[model samples]
Target: MLGTATDAYQPVERRLGITRRIVEVLAETGHPFSVVTKSAGIERELDLIAPMAAQGLVSVYLSVTTLDNELARILEPRAAAPARRLRAIRALAEAGVPVGVSVSPIIPFINEPELERIVEAAVAAGASSAFSIPLRLPWEVNPLFQDWLQRHFPDRAERVMARLRDMRGGQDNDARFGTRMTGEGVWAELLRARLHRVARKHGLRTERRPVELALFQRPSKPSAQGSLF
Candidate 1:
């Protein structure tokens, strides 16, 4: 998988073409892979991806945090706009790629309110699956995110942190394996239930699509060259 925990299609990748090269190699080798990103820039690879997708060799997930343009700008300033991402979802789905939507890092009282709406919009744009994760403030991100909240959402910053702590066992962050991804409190349970309900209502799968590993071909080793004495 690509861009599952870290985005492979960042803006810099456009100029570097590293992700593109990786996709080319995977396509050439008939390896099945999945990608997740918030950038519509992935559309640039449709030529290679669309073909692999035809053989069920590739799938893509677009992460749409919020639909409000202003909120999206402040939240994910560098990523593609919500509308552009929806367009990319449509394009990928139209090309037969198994496209999904991730309304992730759900910040309570922020973008959380739009969970249902975002899933509904993505479904309308051809997404076949959906998933979400509550906001995680790991390591130094805890303080940094708090500062950000104080700056951008001063009026509700305290409330936001208070609710987040309630979900994090009265702490700023929890790094436990199982509970890290999905919080363990009543709020977290409610978030999970809400997502599951909405996903079912829209006929979207909440689980990820399994990639076909049997199709992966091991690349041949390069022949050793004789050294010139």
Candidate 2:
């Protein structure tokens, strides 16, 4: 659907009202779509989404990096607090909208220890599924994140990079098709196993069903009528 490296509901969305209009159109067109957001601002548009969820045309996935307030602040300074994200998840689920949690860009030593806690918290907050990915530092992101890591976590920054390199086959990034998202080597394997175990323990969906393409339809373009010779 709509979610693919872009967040539909950003802070500016509150003012621009663009995403709201987009959601309304999706609802009217009966097109299934998903939104991934880091803010509770999405709550403002849930009224438009709830009815769509009844038709399985909408789903919301909130990204939470960590539950620790201190770490969360540093990790996502402008994002909604971890607690607020959970509340939004609960509210959406209460409204009969399918809700999911994404503990994305899971840093190795920083927030990896909180994996189980994060997933459990989402489950308690009514998430139907959960997923995560190891941090991938690419191009400029690599240097920027490294700088931040050094500034904030000087002691453990090198260790974190080392772990990432091991996962990436001795480099900062591994961009291969299958290995990029999950990475490789021991740590990556363990991470996958742990993810599966935790998801199973809480009865969350580990494998998502492919989107039903049949639900999508495009209005036919009108023909130039009466094109007489």
Candidate 3:
């Protein structure tokens, strides 16, 4: 919930300790929350997170798209390296925090080939759950992705887009509520099946563990008056 839709641990937020401050407030208020991030920076909050995790109030998911260092560097230049993410998973799990992996935006002929490998690596590093979403190129992202694809994978750029279209019902993206997150058609079904099998084999759940809401305590309002010396 923290970083899947929008990364709260972005470079600037991390540098300013914004995300950490948020976590501090959550911890103080006993509010349960989940963190999804591709940054290894989450490790820095283990002191606060570990205790909450002990009460089933928190969980973490690390997004890892590929295991190949070179490919990862080019694809997610700003994110942490694949190996470092695995380490983060291990660190979280060892501290008794329930951790998972999100192999999101699975691009065909690109990171898709390494889906199982990425999950396996995460499991080995102590991940207990996993999930993924196919790549979606909506609006401006479609052209931008195409341009990048042509530049980096000119040889298979067309093929890749063609296959994605196959999954998206002949379009670059399907914005339908039911089908948007999980695409339709043969290719999408195949991806779903593959992920299910691998997740089962690794004893990893395909869904995130639910956090406890019963422990939530409403944060008290701050005083209107300034402190007097």
Judged by lDDT, which candidate is best? 3
Instruction: Pull out the clashing pairs in model 3.
Output: none
lDDT of each: 0.90, 0.85, 0.91
- Segments of candidate 1 deviating more than 4 angstroms: 220-229
TM-score of each model, paired residue for residue: 0.94, 0.91, 0.94
Displacement of residue 25 (Cα, Å) in model 3 is: 1.0
For every model shown, the clashing-pair count is 0, 0, 0
- Identify the superior model by lDDT, candidate 1 or candidate 3: 3
TM-score of 3: 0.94
By TM-score, rank the candidates, best first. Answer: 3, 1, 2
Clash number for candidate 3: 0
User: Higher lDDT: candidate 2 or 3?
Assistant: 3
Q: Which stretches of candidate 2 lie over 4 Å from their true place?
A: 209-212, 217-229
lDDT of 2 by residue, 92-162 (tens): 99998888888888899999999889989999999988888899987889999999999889999999999
**Alpha-carbon deviation at 17 in model 3, angstroms:** 0.9
Better-scoring candidate (TM-score), 1 or 3 = 3
